[model samples]
Each structure stands twice: as C-alpha cells, then as structure tokens.
Target chain A: MKRKISLNPVTRLEGHGKIEIFLDQQGNVANAYLQVPELRGFEKFCEGRPAEEMARIMPRICGVCPEAHHLASVKALDALWQVEPPRPAKLLREIMCCAHFIHSHTAHFYVLAAPDFLLGPDADPARRNILGVVGKVGLETGREILKHRRYAQDIQAIIGGKATHPVTGLPGGLSKGITPGEREEILSKGKSCVEFARASLQIFEDAVLQNKRYLDLITGDVYRLESYSMGLVDDSNRLSFYDGNIRVVDQEGREFAKFAPGDYLQHVAERVEEWTYVKFPYLKNVGWRGFTDGKTSGIYRCGPLARINVTEGMATPAAREAYEKMVDTFGGKPIQATLAYHWARLVELLYAAERLVELAEDDAVLDPNVRALPTAEPGEGVGVVEAPRGTLIHHYRADREGMITGVNLIVGTTGNHAAINLSIRRAAEKLIRNGKVSRELLNMVEMVFRAYDPCLACATHSLPGRTPLEIKIYDSRGNLQERLWQ
Target chain B: MAVKKVVIGLGNPILSDDGFGIFAAREVECRLPAGAPVDVVEASLAGLKLLDFLLGYREAVIIDSVKTGSGRVGEIYCFTPEALRETVRLASVHDLNLATTLELGRMLNLPVPEQVTIFAVEVADNTTFGEGCCREVAAAIPQVAEQVLVHLGIESATG
Candidate 1:
C-alpha cells in the first residue's frame, strides 16, 4: 500500500506552501515535495503598463522585500533607457540597498531563526518564538534591534520615499538628491548600525557558536547539501549587493561562469515542475540533472550561504574579517551546511552596515546632480541585484513609447526552489522513520525550510499577517495517523 | 501629556479588495475636520514593519482586510489587541503577527499605544491583482471610516 503524508498550513489571504511525503509498502519515506500556491498571470498582468511603473508596482509584489524589488526594477529601468545615473545617485542607491540588507537580515536572524537556537530547538512550541527570544536575550536587546531596524528604515525612507513600498526609482536617477543634513544623519545612523552589527555577531558567537549542540547541528550532515552557488560580485570579485556581474561557482569553489545580467537567458533556464508553482532555476550549460546536487547537476543554491561561498571575500574591512573567521571555522571553502546561512547573513549584515557608513562619508553623496536625462529608446533590459535572499533578476521588454510588452523575474527565493525541495526531502528522510512522526521531528524538517527563509506569495500584504502550514501523516495502510498544525 | 491617535490603513492598493483598508484610511483622512487629533497613514506592510508606524502614538486604530472563511462579503468587525492575542499564533514563516508585534513593543518598553483597535472588513477578493476594492468592499470603506471617526470620539464634519 502507498501512503501519502501532506503538510498544508493554509492561512487566510496569505500564500500557502506545503510538503508531502510518500511512503512505500515498507512504510519508509520514498519521495517528498515542497508545493507553493500558484500566483497566476503576473507577466500577463504587467503587459502594456509604463515600464517605469515597475519600480513602484513591483515593490508591492512582496511586502517583505520591497526594497530589493525596487532596486532591481530601477536597475532594469536604467538598462531599458540605456542611461547611467550620476555618481551621487549610484552611491545613494547602493547605500539604501545596503540599509535594506541590514533591516531584512537582522530581522530574519533575531525574530525567525534565533528562537530555534536560543530558546532550544525542542523548547515548548508555545515559547519557541520571538517572544521567547526576547525573554531570554533580554528586552534591552529587543529595544536595540528595534532601534536599528528603525534606523535602517529611516535611511530607506529618506532615500526611497517610503519604508516598505518605495517610490524613488526612475530611469536615470532618483526623483531627488540627498541633502547635507540627511547625509550627516545617515552617517551617524550608519555608525550606530556598525556597532549593533558587531554586537549581533558577538551575540551569535556567544549564544549559538559556544553551544556545542547548536554548533554541531549547524554543521551536521542532515542539513548539508553539496551544490553549486551563485551571487553578485564587483570588479574585484567581492560580494556586492548592487552593480556587479553574476558569478557562479562549482562545488569545489571554482568559478564556473560570470556574465552580465542581459545574458542571463543564455546561462540560466527555468524548469517547471508539475508539482509546484515555483520554478526551479538551473544553469543552462550544466543542464538540469534532476533535484540532485554536485558539479554535474545544475541545481545551485543562492542567498547568504551561497553568496558567501561564491565570492572571494567581503569588500568592507570588518565584514572581511567576519567572513574569514566563518570560512576558517567551517574548515574551508564551499561550506555546504545550510544552517550556516544565518552566520553568512550576519557577515553580510556587518558588510552592509560598514558600507552604509563608508558611502555616507563620501563627498559625492551630497552632489546636487543626481539624474541624467535618459535619451535611449525603450528596448529589452535586465537588472540584477543581490537581495537579502539572493540574486533578484528583473527583465523587461518595452515598446518605443516605454510601455511594457513582456516581463520575467527570477526572485531570490525562487532561485532556491529545487534546493529547498531537496533539503526538505533530505530532512524528512533522516528524521521520519518507521512510520512515526513527532512534533520535534517535524520542527527539524521545518528548520531546513526556515533556513532558506523562502518567501512564496510574498507580494501580498493581507491582514492577520502570516504563512500557515498543516501536516498530516498517513500510515502504510492509507490510514491517517497524526496531524500537526502550526 | 496629551494623547495622539493614528489610524493606519493596511493592505496593498493594487490587490483588488485587499486595498479596502487603504481606501478606508484615505476616507477617514479626507473627511476629518481640521485640527482633529488623529493622523491617517497607509502602509502595505505587516508585523514589525507595522509597529514602526504605530510608534509614539497613544492610540492606534488599524483598518485592514480580513477573511474569516465565513460567507460575509463586506461585514466589518472590531477587535482589541487582547482579543487578537489569543488567536494570533507565531507564524512558521515571517516573524510577529499584530498581537506579537504589540506584545514585543510593550516588552521592550516602547511607547506602544495603550489602546489598540483593529477594524477588519470581510472581503470577497484579495488575490486578484488590480487597483481599488470590489464593489462590496468599496462600499464599506466610507462606513468603516465613519466608524473609526466615531470610535475616536470625533464627530464627522462631512456628515
């Protein structure tokens, strides 16, 4: 008899992604899949709108990472009109982008990921949350976090016009330039961010790394996957959030391909599976080798760990040190431990904070000239940016009058769809055995997905505000055995 | 110190009926008499992002779209933060719902509004991508805005 175990945690107005486990006659796990809800007709929805509206509209697609979408859309606009923004605008954009990184990465670590480690993974389900984290880490830390989060938002709001859904993007430049007072304030906030970032790393070192069990779990084989990695790199191959060529590295950490965003189609292809709404993006040259990993397989990972793995080092001094420490601790290059995503996220956070300060102090940040009138005809363009999750790609083709004709976007989370499925399956296989499923075991499975911080159905901002998961286990005789709701 | 009140409209404006909250907030903002002690703002964000806007206010009236799985197309319900605390569980993805965000604000000793009320409208459409709410939801916007004004003890000038 074949039994299927399904996990569907559906929430009102929010998107639903599920996991299903198939059991064979022996009552052993055979295959598992991560299924996300279908958000239909996004490209069809964009046809005939002014291409420039994408910067404003795309941000609404995902309330969580709107800044990432805004930056990517603006970059695509820059490419579409073939205009280069002045130096001040470029620096200003990068500063805001870095601030966005800080806000997102910090929130993910403290609120979502930290509770698992700090409150103990097997802690009471009721207390295993941000409240639990705040309880243990102290309320002062929470205050500091809130303060820095506000600082990041203030920076973004000052630059992008709003915190969540921004409106400052244009074809050649921002709608406005920074003032001297704003620069001074941003620089001061940036310094404070740097301090907070360092303290965050210290907290991780003390709370997570010092604990033997958590450290072991982080580097353990259950969460490990040997796969290629991809991220954005500047001219010197340093990890860069904005303005860089796309870089891909093999499992051994050798550079595989580095190409401009316009050539993305030639290097990458999306594989649509009948099981899920999310598409699996894979390298075209290596081809799609199923859901498996390794050099021969096209399944590569993105986000913090993948970004760290693919780059030479962080550009900023403090971040470079943090990167070296992490690389050394992990025993070398190509750290396949998926849980290290949290650690790599911290390193990136430090880099972003440092970069924010560096850019604020630069003289050109106060330049009066920000926009250069775009003169090029509307055509096809591609914009790539390293979002908090991973590489965010926005491609658009517009008519001569600048109306959008076609749109294709490979969001950061979608890039890791195949890898996420593989990770879920690997965790399920190891934790679920003999047709038994426990809450603890299920959480372990969830930890794998949580590490990716996958944001399917991200664009919508409905009320009650959360994604839900429901898990149902069936016995080998096709009888329902257990159900877990979260 | 005199208390300040803010009415936050929450939801995406482009996602059909999901925009009711925003529209309602705008209605409240437009119809309020001059020198009213209330400020109206719109945000397409949730969780901690929502808390950022609610900070420094003594009271917050949140207007947003809600789906309860029942067949009410445009019915509106009022709720307190305490009432929501019981139902808002920690999400598997994304940190903090409304209840937790407020809870954390208090725990951190932030000036979270002492009184928090949520005005949720049951809507028919939230997934469809378009501007403006569906007719049923759009009809409730003015009623909801007037209700918010009355809740604040401020008489509507337009009425």
Candidate 2:
C-alpha cells in the first residue's frame, strides 16, 4: 500500500515550494520531490533591451539577491565590451560584494537557521522563529545583530547607492568614486563587523557544537549525503566570491574540473522534469543519473558548504583560522553533512567581513581612476561570481550597438535541485514510519531542505503580503490524515 | 515640527500587474503639492530590508500587490501590519519575512514607523515578464493614489 503525502507550499522558505513524499506499504519513504513554480519568458524579455540595462533590471528578478545580480550583470557588460574596470573600481565592487555577503548571511543565520538550534526543532511552530531566537539569546544580542546588519547595509548604500538594489556599477567602472572620509568610516565599520562575525562563530560554538545531541544530528547519516561540490576559486585556489574560475571537486575531495565562466557550457547542463518547472543541473561529464548521489551521479552542490569544500582555504586570516577549525571539526575535507552548510556560512561571513576591512584599508581604494572607457565592439560574454547561496553565472549576447540579443542565467539554488530532493527523501525515510507524519517528523524534513537555502522563486518576485505555509498528510487509502496551515 | 511621511511603492516595474503599486505611488508623487512633507520612493524588495524604507518615519504608506483568491482584480484593500501578521506566515528560506522583521524591530527598539498603512491592489498577472500593467490594474492606479491622499487627510487637486 503505497501512499503519498504532500507538504504543499513548504513553509518558511523563499519563493513557493512544495514537497511530496511517497510512502511504502510498510510506511517507509519511497521518493520525494521539491517542486517550484518557474517564472516564464525572462530571456525573451531581455532580447531587445540595451545590454547595460541588465545591471538595473536583473536586480528585480529576485529582491533577495539583487546585489549579486547587479554586479554579475555589470561584469557581463564589461566582458561584452572588452573593457577593464580600473583597479580602484574593482576594489570598490569587491567591497560592495563583501558587504552584501555579510548582510545576507547574517540575516539567514540569525533569522532563518538559528531558530531550529536555539529553540528545539520540535518546538511549537509559533515559538520556532527569529523572535523566539531573540527571546532565548536575550534582547541585547538582538540589538547588536540589527546594528551590525545596519552597518553592513550602510556601507553598501554609500558605495552602491542603495543596499538592496544597487545602481552604481556600469560597463567598465563604477558610476562614482568614494572620498577619503567615506573610506575611513567604512573601514571603521568593517573592523566592528569583523568583531561581530567572531562573536557569531562563538555563539555557534557554544550553542550548537557543544550540544552532543545536536552534534550527532548534524553528522548523522540522516542529514548526510555524498555529492560533488562546486565553487569559484582564485589563482591560489582560495574561495573567491567576486571573480574566479569555477572549480568542482568529487565526493572524494579531488579536483574534477576547473573552467572559466565562458566555458560553462562545456561542463554543466540542465535537465528538465515534468513534475516541476525548475531545471535540475548536473556535471556534464558525469551525466544525469536521475537524482541519485555519489561518484557516479552528476548531482553537485553549490553555496557555502560547497564553496568551503572545493576551495583550498579562506583568503583572510581570521576566516582562515575559522575554516581550519571547521575542517578539523568535520575531521577532514568534503564534509557531506547537509547541516554543515550553516557552519560553513558563518566562516564565509567572517571572511566577507575581514575582506571588507582589507579592501577598505588599501591605499588603492582612494584612487580616482575608476573607469576605462569601452572601445571594442560588443559581443557575447559570461560573468561568474560566488553569490551568497552559490555560484551565479550571467551570460549575454549583444550586437555591435550593445543591444542584448540573448540572455541566460544559472542561479545558485537551481544547481542543488536534485540534491535537495534526495536529502528530503532520505530524511523522510528515516523518520516517518507506518504512515505516521507528525509535526516533528515534518520539521526534520524541512531542516534538511533549509540547509541548501534554496530560493524557489529565484526569478518570480511577487508578494501576496503574507506567508502561506501549508502541510497536508495522507494515509495509504489516499485519505487526508492531518492538515496544518500557518 | 513637520510630519515625516513616506510613500513607498513596492513592485517589479517590469512585471505586468505587479507594477500597480509603483504606478499608483508615482501618480501620488505627481499630484502632491510642491513642498509636501511626503517622500516618495519605489522598491522591489520586502522583508527585513523593508526596514530600510520604513525606519525613521512618523507615518508610512506602503502600496503593493496582494493575491487573495476571492478578491477581484483591481480591487484596493487597505490594512495594517496587524492584518498581515495574523494571516501570513512569511518564510523566505533565503531571508526574513515582514512579520518576523517587524517583530525583530520592536525587540531591538528600532525607530520603526508608529503609524503604517498598506494599500494592496488585487493582482491578475504578476508572473509574466513585461513593463505595463494590465488594463484594469492600470486604470485603478489614479484612483488608488487619490485614496492615499484621503488617508493622509490631504486634498487631491482633482477633488
């Protein structure tokens, strides 16, 4: 007696997503799917617009990661026109990106990820949230988090003009240059952010790592899956968020392929499924093996854990120390535990903050030469960056007059579609028995999904002005067992 | 002391009916008398980042789109954050939602607006990628702007 249960519109995640779990006759899990509604006609919309407008319009795709889109689009334009942004402008762009990572990762860690650990995962739905985390952590820490977040946003607002949807970058350089006074203020704030990031890691160490039960849950087979990881790396093979060649490591932590953004088509391909609008991307060399894991499956992960797993080390000293501690904690390279993504995110947070300080303190930051005018004819180009979630690639084609002819994008979350589904299936199989689906059991499933931080509505930017999360369970006879709506 | 009022238009201007709120807000900006205390801004964002537009204001009016199954297209609904707090359980997976952000703001004792109003137009098409709103949604913008003026206790020139 196989039965199906649908958690329609998975709760507490970006965009609209649903997961369906199939139960075997004995109530064991058979399969699961993470479904999302895909927004349509994006490439067609960009066809006739000027290539430069992508910097402004791309941000509207997802209000959550607009800064990533803005920068990636600008980089694509620079590549299209064959112009190089001056060193100072490049530093400015990198600093802005660092600020974005700090702001985004801070919100994710405190608001979304912390609740499960701070309050037990099985706690009442109402109490398992940021407000609940604040209650347990104390009001003072809440204020500090908000203040530091504000500081990060302020830095972006100063450099990029607005924190969320920046409009500062152009084809070859930034639209404006910063004065020495503004530089000093940003530097001072960067120093404080470094301190804040350190405190954040300490909190994780005290709250999560110290709890034996939590540690076991994090490393347990239920939450662990072996998959290849992908991220951008600099010349030294350190994690590079702004610019680098794409790197992929196998399950055994050996470099499998390293290629430039322009050569992305040579390595990655998308597999479409009828059940869901979202496309599953896999390593072309490995080929698509139907949502399975291990050395044979082409499914690979992107984002924090992947970034840390594929890279040699963190670029900044404080972040390097944190990275070393994390690797040592995991006992080696290629930590396959899905929950480790949260830990990896914190390390990147520290790196972003430390790198912000480094970039601001550089003498070159004050230089006035920021733009190099474009002279080459417009052509096809691809830009790649390590967005907070994972690797983001922006590809564009343009005529000699710089009008866009075609646009293609590979966002961070889409890369993990297959892996996310696999993790959900594994968690459900281990937890659910005899057609039993409790709130706690369902939350355990969500915990695994949350680790990927998938943005289901990566392209759809719509607001119903409310969060609608519904979960429905069914028995073997196709009868609804329980329904919860929040 | 002058009353600090901010009118925020929330939508993706390139999306079809999703741009209703932005078009309405822009109309409100145009009709307001010169030297008015209102600061009009448009954004394609929500959740914690909204605190950026909402903080440091004595009064704030936010115009956006909402999709309730029963509501008619072009219908304008006025409500407070309390209305949203009760019904919507926002989870961005990638970021915090509005209710959580507002609660966090109160916890941090940030200077969040004391009085806030939301004008959510029922939307027909928010999925398609385009610049213009649907005809019905477009027609509702000026009327919505006038309603906003009434909420502010100010007279519209047409009135």
Model 1 ranges off by over 4 Å: A10-16, A457-459, A464-469, A474-486
DockQ of each: 0.44, 0.58
lDDT tens readout by residue for model 2, B1-159: 678799999888887887887899999998888777889998877777788788888899999887775788888899887777677664543366666677778778988888888888888888788888888788889988999998987777655
Q: What is the DockQ of candidate 2?
A: 0.58
Clashing pairs in 1: A8-A470, A9-A468, A9-A469, A9-A470, A61-A459, A62-A458, A62-A459
The first chain of model 1 has a TM-score of 0.96
The C-alpha local distance difference test score for the whole of candidate 1 amounts to: 0.86
Model 2 gets an lDDT of 0.86
i-RMS of candidate 2: 2.7
For residues A263-365, write the lDDT of model 1, one tens digit per residue.
9999999998877667899999999989888878999899999999988988899999999999999999999999999899999999999999998899999
